[model samples]
Target: MYRIMIADDEPMIRKGLQKLIQQSGQPIASLRLAENGIDALNQIRESCPDFLFTDIRMPKMDGLELCRHTAELDPDIQIVVVSGYNDFEYAQRCLSYGVKEYLLKPISKKTVEAALEKLVYLHSKHTSPAFVSVHRLEEWVGEAEAAIWSLNHETLVKVVQQARVEISSHRLRLHQLIDLLDEFTVLLFKRLHSRDIFLFTERAPLHAADDEDSAWSQFQARLVLFFDELRMKRRGKLKDPVEEAKLYIEAHLAEEVSLEDVAERIGLNASYFSQLFKQSTRETFVQYRTRRRMEKAKKLLAQPHYRITDISGEVGYADHPHFTKTFKKYAGCLPSEYRNKLGIDR
Candidate 1:
């Protein structure tokens, strides 16, 4: 059983959250509600609750200030920021203060339940010493972080799986195992952020399972999926901006194209785009466009139906002599001579 507190200026929000938590089936020994941060802080001083739920904006001692105070008073208390504001800065600030969860407004019952499950697991981990020690867990997390940074999928998965085996050998309850896994995830997130990866903003919610084996399997699958995403991002394979730019260039090859135009279209600065384009394609944007234009002109020249001047206009060159000069440089022969070698004449 655990004690919980909810602090918000809105009566409806406070009551609604209280009802949701009660129905969540968590082991709540007592639940307290406060209309403002000041009241919540006062209640916390009287008796610090196991968990604190608060809104960012409130009369007298806003939630941010309250979080600071609560962290100073009791670092053990798990704080969840239930704010209507979806600003990233607020969420980042709350995380800095060791807030466990940050839920946006219009909260859903499922989301609340998921958060409670993880927070309760955290509380149990804190109160019990039978589980792994802080130092050992830190060592495991450090190993996992190194593996993740190096994109060593095998070693990373092995590290987590080995930890799970040790935890299971202790014969902990199903929820405790699940909670410990969630705690490991939170720690992993913090570690990766310190390395500048920043893949996850919060601990991912676990899937509901009735048994330990199923729960463990689900967790393993989630870990594998996360690793795949990390690998792709590290390799620059996921949503490649250069690939997008290349597709745009291919489609508009016949139109007047500039590096600046392509960069702005793809939402990147012109200079950065130039560098990325060269790195990905091994050619400058102008070189690529020119090569593509010459390729198209050669294909059209083989037909003998289109005039060289018309081919020039088709490839975005209104100046016939300029097109001929570029084609000669690209193909090692004048356009007319190349056509003659193909056994076509106009």
Candidate 2:
């Protein structure tokens, strides 16, 4: 079974091709349609299709550019250009972009079936028994590891799904599929360990299944759940350090605070902590501290009994004039001006 996408500007063409493909009795697992090249590319990025049937000219991005990007994204994808142009230059360019077939407009059932037959043959040839070696398991594991590190759940799930499909299509024995999944899990464990991820504790072993489909389903579920746990653990782990630093900063808002001081208090390297803080809060440590101090100064300025000079000292500013300048920059007015605008007499 193949997942297919059709891209064309004409609604009638898109619907016609979809109908013909459905009626062609091809083993299609799913079908998608796109009104333009850009929409097709976006759909491809979310979930890659086994085959792409696209028109040459569309709004936003053209077919040539879509073909180029699709080739870059997944060279293994079989592309069929369903354009009305019938231009030699377009065919030549598509060939260069690795398009498997080009069908001219006014497509008939015979031509569509022929293209599908050729594409199916090519697909089967590519996924032959010779291609399903033990090395393929390693490739999947490598791809899964990269996805896990990047925290891309969609890509990770897609990798596992592809593995299942390939194993099922190749008719690997139940035992062979289990062995492949076991090896994949072991490899992921070692790779994640090397990166200090350490997700092995309290993990359950793979479940046994009598059928290959059941085995694949169990493996997929276990792997995805494992990744979900890893994501949550890492997320919480990352937040702990940043949260500790934030608490320490809040506690010392009225005192001199430096990035190094907070990093040391949180037991993280200064440079790493700086990067992590910015990534988490979208603010540098200095910027966060300054903003907090200004917020405190604003509250103090609003109190009629608090002198501006005393307010500056209370917010970790030893120099009154400097605090007044910073307050002007931050709030668009000096401390006295701000209080006066608030209708408070000092």
Query: Which residue pairs come into collision in candidate 1?
Result: none
Instruction: Please provide, for model 2 over 129-237, each residue's C-alpha lDDT reduced to its tens digit, 9 standing for 90 to 100.
Output: 6246767878898899898778898998899878777777765534446666777787876777687655432224455565667777766665664565466466565
Candidate 2, residue 187: CA error in Å? 19
Worst 10 residues of 2 by lDDT: 197-206
TM-score of 1: 0.38
* Tens-digit lDDT track of model 1 for 1-346: 8789999999999999999999999888889999998999988876668889999999988999999999987788899999888899999999999999999889989989999998988978875744667787788888877887778888987897788778766765555556667776678768777766444334354545556787777666555544544665666644666778878887887799899999898766686667557645778999988988899899999887898889998898978899999999999999999999998877
Give lDDT per model, in order. Answer: 0.81, 0.81
Clashing pairs in 2: none
RMSD of each: 19.8, 12.6
